[model samples]
Target: MTLRTIVVDDSIIFRKVMRDALSAIPGVEVVDIARDGSSAVDKIVAAKPDLVTLDIEMPGLNGLEVLEELDLRGIQTNVIVVSAHTSRGAEVTTQALSMGALDFILKPDNDNAGANLAQLKSELARLLKMVKAQPQLSMVSSSPAKSETLSAPIVARAPVRTTKTTSVPRPVECNLENLKTPKFPHLCHAIFIGISTGGPKALASVIPKLPATFTIPIVIVQHMPPLFTATMAKSLDNTSALNVVEATHGMPLAGGGVYIAPGGKQLGVKADARGNVIAVVTDDPPIKSCKPSVDYMMSSVPSSIARNSLAVIMTGMGDDGRDGVSYLRQNGCTVWAQSAESCTVYGMPRQIIENGLADFAFDLDDLPNLLSQLAYRAGGYCPVPPIPSTTAPMMATN
Candidate 1:
């Protein structure tokens, strides 16, 4: 199926260049072009393209203004920001993301415009695929038969309960004393996690259950836009017993603390002169179209923790964590994937599982118990056996 797109920019030359770049991508067709944000809104309301490429610095109701208008009008078209490569541009682009833009591309300068344009073409194609495969829209809007055909596998794999329970206990508050040290020898210095799709809800369920006595620092790469990650961190902080914040460069990784990579930056763990682990945030080129790519984080952890790391790949839309999981496993760091039945989208975990990269395949509900067991073992407090296969049989529904 063809993905209809619209280009909105004030610069005539840039618009033409973007048009050509998008046209080169298969299954994508540009349906309209607008000179500025106001006209872009008009064209969007009329043409209703599946995607939009919006320039940030346009005159007469800038890119962000257009997004605000679209939101007010309840338009849900995927919008990608095309902005100049400057600190101010980055800040504005980040703000646009908070306002609900899906992604951003640094505008190419005249010197390397061709190469950058080609990169944009690749990025646009990737965006198209993600938009088309978005399960929420497809499942809610399509006819029952069509939705069944599209979502049968996912529905069939969902978990079942013997009895529905409406009441859930409030999560305990995180504190150092609450962290329980384990009896087993220390095997890992850091914990790495990658999640996507239904990650927000899943994280809310799991993170709060983590003990504040957990000694190793935790880092996460959840597939999300800037503003969304910020909100997610805040939500986690409120629910979790431990402190949860968006990661910043040079910050120490405190025990029982969780650091979420900020949007628009790739997060890496680096050692300081003191040999302490610190967070590094950079505007380096994205890995797999995600600033805080799971593979990027997983690949770096083994080095940062020096063979004493644990990598976990969870629900997501693609195989971004597959290679990193392999790297961690080969290097003697433990690696795990969320089992298919418990996932909202099983793409990342499925890749790791199919490749035999996972040391443990766990259900989401069982994760808190697993972590508690791991902690007990690490602190020489208890003897927990190796994690067993937690994959449940797929449930079928009419």
Candidate 2:
């Protein structure tokens, strides 16, 4: 089956290059090209293509404006955003995903045009195939308003006392006064989460669901570029009870907060002078073509909480979290995967689910309650302990 596609960019060269590149992917047909947003909208409507490669900085309407126009007009097409590797572009691209784009590709700097072009081809091919395989992806991307849920076995994974989760709640502004001490005296010490494509919106849905009383520190590895991760952290922080921030080296992990792995770097944790676990951000090499690989971060985590911590693999388009889930599971940690129906891209979670690595699989909406249950499992929170200075020797507390 040929996937009819359109390449929309202001640059004549990129449009031609993209057309040539996508044409090489098996079962893909470059149906047309649009050099601007207005033209893009018209070409998209006329061609009725299955996919669109849209540049974020196009003249006239720009990629984001095109998306909004498409949404207003109710035009349905799988949009793969093409963005420059910048903090601003990253911000807009994430907004596009939340607005309904399938995914995005970063434009490498001009110094390595040849290498960047080669990378783009492989990325496009992989994403196009994902769209083809998942019938529900069509509904989600084309009409951001509708949710075509698949009948997942939510009961299989829900904790014994969990009730049915009917809908995702709207986001609320954060309040830090409700913040507790870093040490989680409860049974669940920490939460490790990983996500990729369709992550911005998915995180918004899941994170805001955690109530203010929820006090476990959460570490997240969302596959994103450098500036993009920071933007995401701020976005999640604004709407969540958890005080979310981008991970920085030496920052101690504490309860009631969320840390986003900085883009382009590996994020992990280590024991500080006081034996308290602090953030470890590094320039480690990429794993499986991804910097800040889920496996890398997950491995850095100590196995002490394997019995009490919760590890989650959410929406994504690849097997990034597979080995990480394995590592956590081997240490006796309970692992959860977002159900296929609830995921924008099911690749990461599907990997663990198929391998018997995930201890449970639940819809994205169901996870918040499960995590809340995990947070308070020991029955109550540990009384607030004295705060220590940064340079003060840390003591082990969970």
lDDT digits (tens) for residues 1-398 of candidate 1? 66688999999989998999889988778999999989999999888787889998988999989999999998877787887766567557656764666666667775687887887777677655666665433222222121111221121111111112112122234232222232222665677899876676578778889877766667999876666577678778887888999998879876678899887777766555444667767666666666777766665542435366677888777767665666666667777778766775667776766555666778889888787677666662221222224422111121
On lDDT, the candidate that comes out on top is 2
lDDT of 2 by residue, 55-168 (tens): 988778988899999999898888999987777887888788778887888875656777767787888877876777666666332333222222332221111111122231
Local distance difference test, each candidate: 0.68, 0.73
TM-score of 1: 0.55
Would you give me the overall lDDT of model 1? 0.68
Candidate 1, poorest ten consecutive residues by summed lDDT: 152-161
Q: What are the runs in model 1 whose C-alpha is more than 4 Å off?
A: 112-119, 129-191, 195-216, 221-251, 256-293, 299-318, 326-350, 353-398
**All candidates: CA RMSD (Å):** 13.5, 10.7
Q: For model 1, how many clashes? A: 15
| TM-score of each model, in listed order | 0.55, 0.78
